[model samples]
Target chain A: EAAVTQSPRNKVTVTGGNVTLSCRQTNSHNYMYWYRQDTGHGLRLIHYSYGAGNLQIGDVPDGYKATRTTQEDFFLLLELASPSQTSLYFCASSDAGLANTGQLYFGEGSKLTVL
Target chain B: GDQVEQSPSALSLHEGTGSALRCNFTTTMRAVQWFRKNSRGSLINLFYLASGTKENGRLKSAFDSKERYSTLHIRDAQLEDSGTYFCAAATGGYKVVFGSGTRLLVSP
Candidate 1:
C-alpha cells in the first residue's frame, strides 16, 4: 500500500506566526499536492508539484507557498499565518500517468488553528 | 477553471439502506475519483474511473465523460460507511477539481 505521512497532526499558533507542514510519501509517485478543507468550500488545492523542484499553483494559492524538495517529500509553508488560514490541510501523492491517473494517496492531514 | 458540482450536500441513511451521490462537471473530465474522509481526517480512496463503472464491496461508481457527470452508489449502508464523501475530476493540465463534498450519516 502507499504510505503518506504528515507531521504535527495538530497545531495552535497565533496570528502572524510562521507554520510549516511537512509530508513524505513512500510510493515514489511523481505528483504531490497540498489542499485545505473548509466548511463550505470542501477541499481546495493550494499547490502541487509534478516532481522534485517543480511547483504549480492551484485554485487557492494565496497566502500559502509549497516546496517539493524531493520526489518523496513536499512542504507547505505559511509565512504569516492568519485566522483565515485555520483549516485542515492534506497532502497527497500520485503517479499522474496513464498507469495511475486519478488514484491519489493522501496523508492523514494536519489541523492548524490560528488565533 | 474546471468546476465539479456534487449533491446532495448532506445525506442521512439508516443501516441497511442505500443511496447514490452525483457530481456534474462544467467541462469535459478525463477521469473521476471518489474518496471518503473519515472522522479522523484521513482520506480513503474508494474508486477511480476513467470511464464506465467499477465496484468493490457494497460501493459502486460510474463516470461518464461524454455526459460530464459521475455517480457513486452505496448499497447496504453500514455505520462504518458514514463519512464526508468527495468526488474529484481531472480535466487535463494535471489539474484535478474537487466537489464541495457530501456528508453521509448512517444511523442504526
Candidate 2:
C-alpha cells in the first residue's frame, strides 16, 4: 500500500512568522504534491515535484515554496505566514504521472493556524 | 476558472437510502476520480475511471469524457458513509482538477 506521512499535524504561528510543513512517502513515488483545503473550496494545488530536485508551480503557489530534497521527502515552506494561508494542508503522492491506474494517496493532513 | 463543478453542495439521506452525486467538467477530461473524506480529514480514494462505469461494493461511478461529466451512485447508504465526497478530473496533463465537493449526511 502507498503510505504518505506528514509532520507537524497541527501548527499555530503568528503573522509574518516562517513555517515549514514536512511530508514523507514510503511508496517511492515519483510525484509529490502539496494542496490546501478550505471550508467551501476544493483542494487547491500549491506546488508539486516530479523528482528529487524538480519542482513545478501549481494553481495557488503564491506565498508558498516547496522543496523535494529526496525521493521520499517533500517540504512546503511559508516565508511570511499570513492569516490567509491558514488552512488544512495535505500532501499526496502518486506512483508516476497522472494516468488512469495512478491513484493519489494523501497524508492525514496538517492543520496550520496563522494568528 | 473552475474546471470541475459538483452538484448538491450538501445532501441529507436516511440510512439504507440511495442517492447520486454528479460532477460537471468545464472541458474534456482524460479521467475522473472519486474520493470520500472522512470526519478525521482522511481522503479515501473511491474510484478512478478513464471511461465507462465501475462498481465496487455498493458504490457505482461513471465517467463520460465526451459529455464532460461524471456520476457517483450510492446504494443502501449507511451512517458510516457520511462525509464530504469530491470528484476530480485529470485533463491533458498530470495535474488533476477537483470539484468543490458535496457534504453528505447519512442519518438514521
Candidate 3:
C-alpha cells in the first residue's frame, strides 16, 4: 500500500494570510496532486505534478501555488489566502500518469479555515 | 471543461439492502475511480477501473469509456457503509474531474 502523509492536520488563517500545506509520499510515485474539498463539490483538483520540478494547473488553481521539489514531496501554497480558499485539502500520489493513473492513494485531509 | 454528473445526490438504505450510484461523463474519460469519505474525513479508495467490472466483497464497480459512464453497486449494506461517495473521472490527458458526490446513509 502507498503511504502519503500530510502536515498541519488543521489550520486557521485570516484573509491575506499565508498558509502552506505539505505532503510527502513514501511510495515514490511519479504523479502527485493537490485537491480541495468543499460542500456540494466532491474534490476539485488544484495542482498536480507528474514528476519532480513539474507543476500543472488544475481545474481550480486560483489563489493556489504548488511545488514538487522532489518525487516524494509536494507542497501547496495559499498566498494571500481568502475565505473562499478555506476547505479540506488532500494530497495524493500515483505510480502512473495519464491513462490508468487515477488509482490515487491519498493522505488524510487537512482542514483549513480562512477567516 | 470536463464535467461529471453524478445522480442521486443522497441515498438511504437499510442494513442488508442495496443500491447503486452512477456517474455520467460529459466527455470520454480514460478511467474512473470510486472513493468513500469515511467518518474520520479520509478518502478510502474503493475501486479503480479503466474498463469492465470489478467486484470486491459486497461492492462492485464498472466503467465504460466508450459509453462515457460508470456505476458502483453496494450490496448488503452495513453501518460502516454510511458515508459520502465520490466518483472521479480522468479526462483529456492531464486532469481528473470529480462528481458532486453522493451522501449515503445506512440505517438499521
The window of 10 residues in a row where model 3 chain B has the poorest summed lDDT is B89-98
Tell me which of candidates 2 and 3 scores higher on DockQ.
3
The residue-by-residue lDDT of candidate 2 on B59-96, one tens digit each, is: 99999999989999999999999999999888755688
Task: Candidate 1: list runs displaced more than 4 Å.
Answer: A97-102
Kindly report which residue stretches of model 3 are placed more than 4 angstroms away from their true locations once superposed: none
Tell me model 1's lDDT, rounded to 2 decimals. Answer: 0.91
Q: List the candidate numbers ranked by DockQ, top first.
A: 3, 2, 1
Model 3 DockQ reads 0.65
Per-residue error for B95 in candidate 3, Å, reads 1.2
Off by over 4 Å in 2: none
Model 3, A6-70: lDDT tens digits are 98899999999999999999987999999999978878889999999999998899889999999
| Residue pairs whose backbone atoms clash in candidate 2 | none
Per-candidate TM-scores read 0.96, 0.96, 0.95
Per-residue alpha-carbon lDDT of candidate 1 for residues B17-88, written as tens digits (9 for 90 to 100): 999999999998888889999989899999988899999999999999999999999999999999999998
